[model samples]
Target: IPFGFYLFLKTENYIVGWIATLLTGLMVLYAVYTKSLAAWVSISVEAIVFISILIYLVKTGKYQFKIKSRLYALVLTFTGFLLLINIDSGGFNLKFGGLSDQVTSVQEFVQSKSSSGVDVVRSDAAVKGQSSIEWRWSVWLNSMAMIKDNPLIGVGAGNYKIEYPLYNHKVVRDTKFNLESQLDRAHNDYIQAAAEFGITGFVIALWAVVCFYYILFCLFKSDLSDLPGKKLLLAAALMSAGTGMLFNAGFSFPFQRAIPPFIVMLIFAIACVMHAQKIKTSHTSIIDTRLLYAVTFVFTLLFFYIGHYHYTMIKADKYFGRTIRCYNNGNWPQLLNEADKALSYNAGRKRVLFYKGFASNELGKIKESIQYYEELIQYFPNYINGLLNLGIAYGKVGENAKAVETFKKIIVLMPDEGGYYSDAGHYLTKLGKLDQAYTYLKKGAELEKENAIILLNFGVLCMQMKKYSEARKVLKKVAELEPDWDQPKQYLKYIKEQT
Candidate 1:
């Protein structure tokens, strides 16, 4: 896209540049219509470059249209653009026909939230409902604080997601903020790199950026004495691609994507080539043809190796998808097999860790299941299913104490839910900790008011403690909650006899 702009410069055809600018302006309007600030920002770079070219041409007297004519053209063009944006039948239909309402929205929101904006953002985050803007700010601030503490080698590459759940540094926060998912990216490449790579790698990255712009700077200021305007425009166009991506990367994860960062490097490489071309030295070829071919062959092999690596990774995702289908269908053996296939390609896959453990448990490999469930819990401490199933697995293997411990962790993570409390109490009964079991079961029954399963468990615990009257009351409630259940009715009859 930028190369097209460079072509106009090469031919000294400013008319084509003007045409491209006009077309791009329509895109900008559409971006506005769709409320795409990012689209507006990226395409605006071309408009800026064209404007620069226009300024350069006019100053050099190459654009000889009278000033009055230029002003009239600008007014008429802008008017038509507005009409296109606000047409009643097929246009944006924006209120008042322009971006005035957007500006007003900002002003009104700021005025309304001037004193409590931080609280508002924090309250939103408390329930996992933070807007993207607020969410990014929290993650970025927490990540930066983490980086500041570990200023040397970072949290280790690709460890940010794993680290985020345990790290609770806050810039403006609520104590109740509970992140259900670890942020996969900081959403800002610069901050993400700092948190992932630390100062050591960060400085190296900063150096590369400096070197890129330095080359661009040299190209721009180099005495192009008698050199064609083509070089200036070309340099500006190439640099525009890099700058536009740089701007996008500031607020988004362009580096995490496949293409945008590639474009940045491509432009940087082109700029380097341009800078090299300006050298005045008459240098001869430094390498023979045979060595050049050797380099080419080696690079070709490297590319193939990289391609193969990505292919295997993609194959892993394919198997993971199949594994998910099998798991959902309760096909334990197939799920286990597919999970192994995914693990073979990428051993560190987090979800696969739990899926393999779950399938192994379902297939009656209790001992093996314990190990994998333990591994999964270690990987994600706040994982509800992992903790819940791990506790159950521990109980199956007669590790009552371990089961109780795992359920205690779940209770901490989910204090409002009564199921974990009931689970903990059940294990405590097996451990003969009757008093602790009574405490947990009572809490579970209170929290899970209408949960027949919880009430039944609580009633059984009461009977075990020889409190027949309390057992009778709980059993009656369980019978009410589940009228067709034979267990509660049978328990109620037994309690009747005992009473």
Candidate 2:
């Protein structure tokens, strides 16, 4: 991406442009360290295409350069960078593997490295069917089945994650490898959009993509000779990046990222401006001083208008991050203090409220915890974690009624989840609603039949209800499930005495 930007700048300032190579080299090293196959592929493809364009321009006499000097400069800069990296790392060696190695993907490369001196031969077909890739395909396929149910309106926002678990059981049932975990993202933005918002999201995404390419088309089909030197390079560079991004989006969720979309649109906007200027057929420069100033002013105005809000948001995020760190470190007092500071900046932020509640509860300030939880639930009633935590907090405070009510709502949201039913049942037992509690406990045990904790709770509930025979049977099963657990033996002995 930095290399692409360098190409864009090369048109205006050839000397200044080579400096971007420093950024380019560092980014490549970063990609290698991170093992980001997507970043590597994006950079590689862009470099190949952009370099090809440069070669074409020079050969066809459209552009000229001191090729030898530029090549030598590039080599020296990269070599120096690598030397520094090696020195800093105390032996950061890079090697070009034999042609026979032919590592195709980051997964393959990692596999090869982990089993050093072993050849990891992967067939072309197995490349996509590899565990990481295959399960994504399975998810996409399963997600489609779900979308077919209500194609037009979708399952709705926040419903996808809760609801998808039901449809994705087929993949989970696979014995060889249950490669699926969270279906939070389908990893394909287009499909994810369709899954979340239905056909409406798919159409909007498709249209935006089409319009994006149309701008690129306008810029590409223009008389390359007519546009200034840098403008031509700029268009080609943007085209490479935009095309690379489109490809990456198919495999990953770059659209969900913070920077990629903005970069894509920024380049797209530039293309549109260049295309419009061409259609005008004015001999005036494609990017004149007036246009630059206009863009500068508009961006400046926007920053001034939106800057304060972003500053506050950044501040809130930092504090929230610190609160999480505090929570992780088990520093409850600091967590409450940090979370409070964050809430002061963004009082309505759901996570800040949740964390504050969590800290307060951990600090034994139950009333304060309830207040923070109530605030979170007030703003985000359907936030599952907030609701779950709030419900747990209620139980901690002996507000069994509120806890049972909250768990009931959770059961409605996640009916198939045994944990929610267990929560509801546990609270109902506390409230002395024995019959209703039994129904929930039975259902929870049925859903998660092998869940020892829920089964033990159910056994305890049966004992409480004085159904001695049923209690003995349930307690025996719990003993089998947890052979060493003393509670089941004690409960069985008590049940024996009762009988």
Candidate 3:
């Protein structure tokens, strides 16, 4: 697509940025996953090149307007209406859309979660009227922190989740801020690359983008003028192709789809056809058997590898997701077994680590649980589950100071995550940091006042602080929120009797 984009740069800005980006996005969606730096660099460069071309075209008055006939306009209008309906239709809420069948199990999990009182608002909810954006943002921030600590070699590809907790432990140890289960990749491409492949991979990825832009523009200026509409064909193909990739890349994983292969095939086909035409026009040799054979061999190999790779990833992703289901269902043994199976195929998988860590915790192997959680935090620090669990494990081990520090790290990684704040407060209260405990609990309560656990934690803090009136109010709320919880009910009763 990048190569194609440069080819269209000389013809029109409309052909370059907007159109090329859309094409690039579509290709990316077909074959690759964008959770890495390579994909980002590719998209960013194509977008930048297109925008530059657009500006130049606008400045030079070289932009050609394409007028639509009435029939064409009507077709476009109908297509637009159909697309709008598709976008707004609640036919399927799955991200995979038509591919939803392949992920029926995931859809089931989503359905169950929706029924479990979890709002999609988690996507944009404030932890406690604080910036939930910032909370999500912390994943990026902490990921960078991890890269800086181990810049040259990286903690290891897929090691951020494992290393993050150590950094968190070093910085703030009060709350659980595990990264193992909460992330599949670094939310940002640049950060993920630096963490996984170090500075070298980051630089190479950027360089590839630079090369793409140069090639795209060169192709655009190549003279096919004497051949009439030949130039337009080339321009449309490249522009349309690049645009698809860039647009799809903006929000979803385009790289993991078959998009890349199709885009590449389009480019290769254009190059071959154009070269053959140029040779024929020049009265060159009738046939080039060597080049033909090479192209055939290349296509065969590329398709073969692509097919195999796609299937492998599909299988791995499914089993990985199933491991999560096992954990959620409290099938500890199954979780452990499935995690091992997943790791055997794709070792150090962050999601698999979550199952391993949680299952270990459930099985009373605190040391083993901590081991997996710690490893996950180091490699995938952006994830929060491991950190949360690690803090809980520390609490279980009676390492109050370590527990407090862990929770504090969670605050840094996701300050608005009310649950982290609540957990931190609970541990801080245990550590006799009464003032800090009060501050955190109060803040957490404000975020999710309807939360029975948060209110109960606050009531416990108030009781310890000798603020009996505040304690009474908080415990009353706790009782209302969880009438079945004997702890809140008993505490409230004792307070009333004393009064």
Of the candidates shown, which would achieve the greatest TM-score relative to the real structure? 1
- Steric clash pairs (candidate 1): none
lDDT of each: 0.74, 0.72, 0.62
What does candidate 1 score on TM? 0.70
lDDT tens digits, residues 381-495, model 2? Answer: 6556767888988998799999999889767645667889999999999888999999999899888878989989998998888888887887898899999999999999988
Candidate 1 local lDDT, 276-322, one digit each (tens): 77786576885688989999999999999999999999999999999
lDDT score, candidate 2, position 309 = 81
- Rate residue 311 of model 1 by lDDT: 91
Model 2: runs farther than 4 Å from truth?
A: 2-25, 44-187, 192-198, 228-231, 251-258, 281-305, 325-338, 363-368, 409-418, 431-436, 443-453, 462-470, 480-487, 493-499
Candidate 3, residues 1-499, lDDT tens digits: the string is 5554444343344434444444533554432332333344455565565565555444544444332222343344445434433342466233432333324544554554467473323332322332222333445556666778777877776565455544543322212243333344544555666777778777886675455444555544444442324343454445445554644443333533565646655664664455444343554673989998999999999999999877777777777887989977999988888777777766635658867888998899998998898888776665566678889999999987888888887787666568888988888888888999999999999887899888888988888787889999989888888878899878877788877
TM-score of each: 0.70, 0.68, 0.53
Better of 1 and 3 by lDDT: 1
Q: Where is the poorest 10-residue window by lDDT in model 1? A: 62-71
Error of 1 at 247 (Å): 2.0
* lDDT ranking, high to low: 1, 2, 3
Is 1 or 2 the stronger prediction by lDDT? 1
